[model samples]
Target: MPAQLVWFRRDLRVRDHPALVAAAEAGEVLPAFVLDPALERAGDARTAAMLTALEALHRATDGALVVRRGKPEEVIPALVAEAGAEAVHVSGETTPFGRARDRRVERSLDVPLVATGTPYAVSPGRVRKGDGGPFRVFTPFSRAWLEHGWRAPAELPSQHRWVRRVEGEAIPDAPEVEANLAWSAEEPALERWHEFLDGPIDDYDASRDRPDLDGTSRMSIALKLGAVHPRTLLADLDRVAPKRSKAAQRSLKRYQTELAWREFYADVVFHHPRSAWHDFTDALARIPYDEPGASFVAWQEGRTGFPMVDAGMRQLRAEGWMHNRVRMLAASFLTKDLHVWWGHGAQHFLDRLADGDIASNNHGWQWTAGTGTDASPYFRVFNPVLQGQRFDPTGDYVRRWVPELRHLEGKRVHEPWKADDGYAHDYPERILDHAAERQEALDRYEAAKG
Candidate 1:
């Protein structure tokens, strides 16, 4: 039987994989991954994580997973010819770059390039409004998404025959990163999902916002890399939690909505590809943005003196991941308090985040900056000090990443300047007065609108 080439992209796993199953059913399968130079633009943390996952996948496939380096349009055709594959199967890519890349590869291949599924629960453009046009806002989109439900997770192939005739390059070494990745493989991802389902998901609604607590599922990187599918998570949620209790049901629903938010952003990008970098709406089109300067450096280095903002930035530096709530606070501090362009902050995040996804990261930044779909009002400037005290109440979250402020116990850690020994350890002073900047940001918004 001729081999079917399975080209793994974001959808990396063997389980619940439509492309993999389709390839396996066709005949002997040759799994291949390409290390495209263009896609390596993400920072060291994402690079390291992707490499680690690729290594794990190699082992799982019993060393039959072929690793190659080059442009996919060229590399995939060569692999198909070498393997004598009939067709190349893949999980359909939704991003603008991905779609364009696929078209190039398809044009290059002699055999068919069949795309079976995508990295989404319901593929980006599947859930549309009654009029058949895309929904601009999230609430309506999410409602339509639920009404147009996703299929159950695809079943794993009953058997496998991996082709090893083709010679391939060794998986490259991962770049060094400070954050410790607990797990990057398919098995560990499933384990984490089950663990979250066992208990913590019940409190996700109320506790997800508290950065001081270990309250999040932290499956973002896994999802981003396709270590686990959203459908698998959704299936598990239905099987275990919804019937546990009323409160558990609410948490389950909240978690589901959060997942939907991911899909919603992807949908937005699918419809308006330019919005990936440009503002999704024109409300902030005229808003003047300051150039990144000394204050920008302090914000990035976690010395902004707004404990929550500093802690969030430092956490991102050390761990390559920041709490979701803190991510917004940090972004707000950069865009609003520093009066810098959201693009600058968004690019920094994409560079640092292990789970940096283009659609989600950029859109989330725009949302916080009040320039994207369903954005917060322009005047809703987040006060970093108050946000810290409110979300990081005990201030342990701030102390965790900002060691210099550890001396200030309890909530005082959030407002170190008020504490007697706040700057005794040489913690940097506030870069700019928050109240002054808040008004300045507002003025700029009004001026831009006028």
Candidate 2:
């Protein structure tokens, strides 16, 4: 029997998968995964998370998720020759590395490499403006996106006729990275999603900003690994919206906007591949960035002495994730206060985050640095102290992450230096005065404009 070869990458799950379905449409299906040594040897937090998720894929496919390590160019064609696959099938990749790998694989394969779907809900490059160009700003792009809606999720394949006796390397264990694995696999991922959808989703709008509270859906890692599909989530949202109270409906709408932002960044990277390594807006590129010196180390180690920035950094170290609001404050402190380049902060985040998506992580740093599309105002700096006070009103987030300030009471924990009983608990002093750095940042922006 002629077998269909399914080359799995980010889209790990079987249900709601177009590529898997397309591949299975042939006589028999051979599931395969390649460990690109270039990606695996990075030995970062994300690498471990991906391995954990791949384990779930192993179980899902009943040991048929073929694991091989090498250049995809060599491994894939060799697998095809051995399995005698009629065609190599995949959900096409969107990132620069992914695109390059796909091209090379297509060239080497004797049979056609059929691309049925992509990792994105609406594939990047599919939704563009009335003109042929991609949308730079988000609001118009979102409206167009709604108009250019994606198809319903593809049904899972009915049967699995595993073509046995295939020789490939064992699925390797996750690397022994210093960071702990946060989101393990699709099973736990689904539990978290269903829990969030059932209970806390109604409060997502009002409470997503508070780092201390579990107000937001912890689905990013799941989304990153394709443990669950965005279309599946969207369909659930539609099913529940009518039954929800008006307030809950508003909250769900707000949460939907957040998902759309993810797609927007993906689209942004798809059209402007250069933005991955360079500044999206050139106007601010002339500003000189400070060297990653002692101050940079302080920021990385959660010793910045600004409770909000420190707390977020500590949380990242502990959980391999940080709250969305806290991540912004942390990124802002790095770019605007420390005068370090956004790339430095972005790289550090990619090294740590379990949900470290290239498009979202890099563009998020750029957005905060005011160097990317729809940039935050260049002169606007996040006062880490005030951000802590405003978002984490009770100082719970600060105390939770920065245990050094646990002795302080209530929101006063946000400004430890100002406390009457100011406990000088071994926490480092604020690296640079916020006022001083804010002015310094503005001056550089002025110089860049001039």
- Return the TM-score for each candidate structure: 0.99, 0.97
Model 1 local distance difference test score: 0.90
Model 1: per-residue Cα lDDT over 8-100, one tens digit each: 989878788988988998899999999999977879988888887788888878899999999999999999999999999999999999999
The total number of steric clashes, by the backbone 3 Å criterion, in model 2 comes to 0
Who wins the TM-score comparison? 1
lDDT for position 34 in model 1: 96
lDDT of each: 0.90, 0.86
For candidate 2, lDDT tens digit of each residue in 347-420?
89887888888899999999999988889998889988788889999888888888889989888998888886
Residue 304 in candidate 1 has what lDDT?
Answer: 87
Highest lDDT: give the candidate number: 1
- Backbone collisions counted per model: 0, 0
